[model samples]
Target chain A: MKRSSISSFSNPAVIAELAAHLHRNNVASIHIEAADGELKLVAPVGASLQTTHRATPVLISASQPGSLLAKAPTAGIFAAAHPLRPEREISTGSAVAKGDIVAFVKVGPVLVPVIAEKAGKVVSVTSETGTLVGYGTSLFTAKT
Target chain B: MIHVLGCGPLNTIQDLGRAGYRNIGVTATGAMDPIALKVGNLLVGNDEDAAGIEIQTFPFRIEFEQAQVFALTGADCAARLDGQDLPPWWCIRAEPGQVLELSTPMKSARAYLCLQGGIDVPLVMGSRSTSLRGSFGGHEGRPLAVGDILPVMAGTTISPPVNGFGIVPPAQAMPNLFPVSDTGDLILRAIPAGEHDLFGDDSERFWSQTWKITSQSDRTGYRLSGAPLQLSAPVELRSYGIIPGIVQVPPGGEPIIQMSDANTAGGYPKMAGVIDGDLWRLGQARIGSKISFRQSSLTEALAVERAIDAYIDDIRRTLPLVANALVAMTKR
Candidate 1:
């Protein structure tokens, strides 16, 4: 099998053309190697190959290096503190331990706590109070 | 199962109180604040009227014998579990042998503790409330004491981890709908009762003057001290059915407002009855707290009841969805 190299096709238009060809040929998945990077595309179930990229699926491991992003455990309105109490809002740079309630997601009258899964120092809070957040969306970032 | 390590003032098991037995002279004998009890039970996925602990004193403590879910409602007693503070009205799970302690309430007088199913107690006269007078129901018909062991209703099915959710307590000492006096006394809405007109000039003073809850008050009745309220003339009457919130005046001229554990029937002249909607406010009223009464139309009284019902309806509709969502999230 001849290896396909996409180093010469630095323009995005060329990549789009190649993706269109793969779609026409009914290819489900394909990997292209470039001079500085690689692109991998897998067609979604019951669909043809795409021309644009979807969200990059991230695999989070506790041992992963650098800053760790804390994501929403569920979908709801994010609350930096207790809903009835605005003064208890969690601030940036606070120390958090495993299973500590750092924030909440309010659904109706119920507040689901966004607990820390590992001990770390909070670096930033990305979600605003009362803002809607989807599951796995980055809510905050912390350094272990 | 749970063990009572210490009880500060008074702790009694209460539900919505017994009904129908009043015809035979049985007091309802339930929670001083039924709204608190109902909200606490609903938070733990229990029936709204399920039995729970009504803590009247402060610094109460209990230890869970097994891991279970529970909720605290009513007064903000500043509760802590295993040394970590819990927000009032939040439902949290307890690990085995974890101690839950309650300090003096900051806002209201009573606090309720509701378990997932409820506090397991045999119903007496259709309720699990403790009848202090009758002494026949609720943990041997008396207040919970130290070293007492209470059984919790067994969980029917494993529920989702409902660890963080809470609602605002419905009991407000000062609600905006009613008038509040300059002295910060709560103004409870009232309607004319059977002998309302018999009080003559006293009726006018009842609505105008602020009354202080005397130290003699308890679950049975609140002895109010203010301007003396006397009847137009001495009248003899047979004992009649009396419910909670009925304002009765004895010869001493001091008006007494009936409570949850009030006598089923009384011979005192009933001057006015507090509206059902404002009864919860009375329940949260502490000794020395002052209150004034407002003459409200029956229509207005009905409106207050409707608002309370609607608030409860909102909770009933939303709590189940919250519970389900929690379960689904945990499964993931």
Candidate 2:
């Protein structure tokens, strides 16, 4: 559902400021859903994002056949790869084994690995690196 | 419990080290790279000063006799668990009977293997570190040998996600502070010691020339081979109390930098004392590695110490937050 009325009033600078605050504090992402509209801001993961925050309402759809959505196990900053091993980052089209560490959710100084639920090819990475994410946030869409 | 299936000589159990006993003629024998041990312990939910296995000689191999959590830090020894490659500075859980092996490292010289709750060695003189010189602490007062079964203390368990996680090594995380020389020599910061003036013009050579760590080096001290640092004249000085990091010049004129297992007293002339903050880098320096000294002031030394303290403080403050958060998250 498109809320054109509320979308017209969202200020770009306000969103940028919020995103900057999240990055400065090492937070992953924030989501606010109200009766009028929804505002979601995520920090960049691997590389710096050209656009700091995403304010547009996301489209929610049913899972397609053979597709599996890997959700975040807890809330924290999402990392595409371990901080020390960036070259092994999991990306779209990367083949992953069941129980493989496709990414990480960093809480403070500790990094909690984000595991692959099943062996599959990553169809898409829904979460951006360095962005704040909440528990159960869909991080990757993969095809088994 | 873990059984040492294979190990090299000199690999020993060490903690932060024994303090206040150097007066009684006991060397503060401990991990050469103490920072690595502390970080490894912190990663495994152990106290910063917890005892761990400091593995220098390799290929060291061990088998987990029981399920346990462990963290590997310091030198990247290309460790593997049941043939699965693990990154350096990583923490993970191992199932019973899982074999963990470490190969000779290509870069850094020592690797610390810290288990959850630390190694259950009897604390001798207020620490669990082995006093190899005195042969009184750690596992039977000697280095770890094959078939040595070390008991790990019971610790509060926290769940880590499958495949585990790792942190950026301090060398990479805190770069550009005390940088390496452009010529690829390890740069060590030092404060002029008592006998520094005696070297006269030779003191300049000590600072300018890159010294190679000779084969005679060990935990006690690194005998550097470079231009002879002859003093203005021969002067006999009485033997006095000494500690690690003191740069002493003996009759041979080559400088010797004291280390973890340094003798309690020495009679040689002192040139410069390496700053404590940079000692870990020196600890990991391999034999044949080139190193040069950069003169530093007390203010600069304190500043560097503060930066290292901040790094450790960050880990101490944030580890509990992460553990608690993970426990709550897993419960859901």
Give the DockQ-based CAPRI class for model 2: incorrect
Candidate 2 residue lDDT tens string, B84-138: 8787888889999999999999888999999998899899989998888889899
* Model 2 CA deviation exceeding 4 Å by range: A1-94, A121-144
lDDT of 2 at B160: 49
Q: Pick the candidate with the highest lDDT.
A: 2
Q: Estimate each model's TM-score.
A: 0.79, 0.82
Candidate 1's TM-score: 0.79
lDDT of 1 by residue, A28-134 (tens): 55555455434443333334323333433332223433365466655456778764455767667788877777787655555667777778888778768756554
DockQ of each: 0.14, 0.22
Give the count of colliding residue pairs in each prediction. Answer: 0, 10
Best by DockQ: 2
Judged by whole-model lDDT over C-alpha atoms, candidate 2 comes out at 0.81
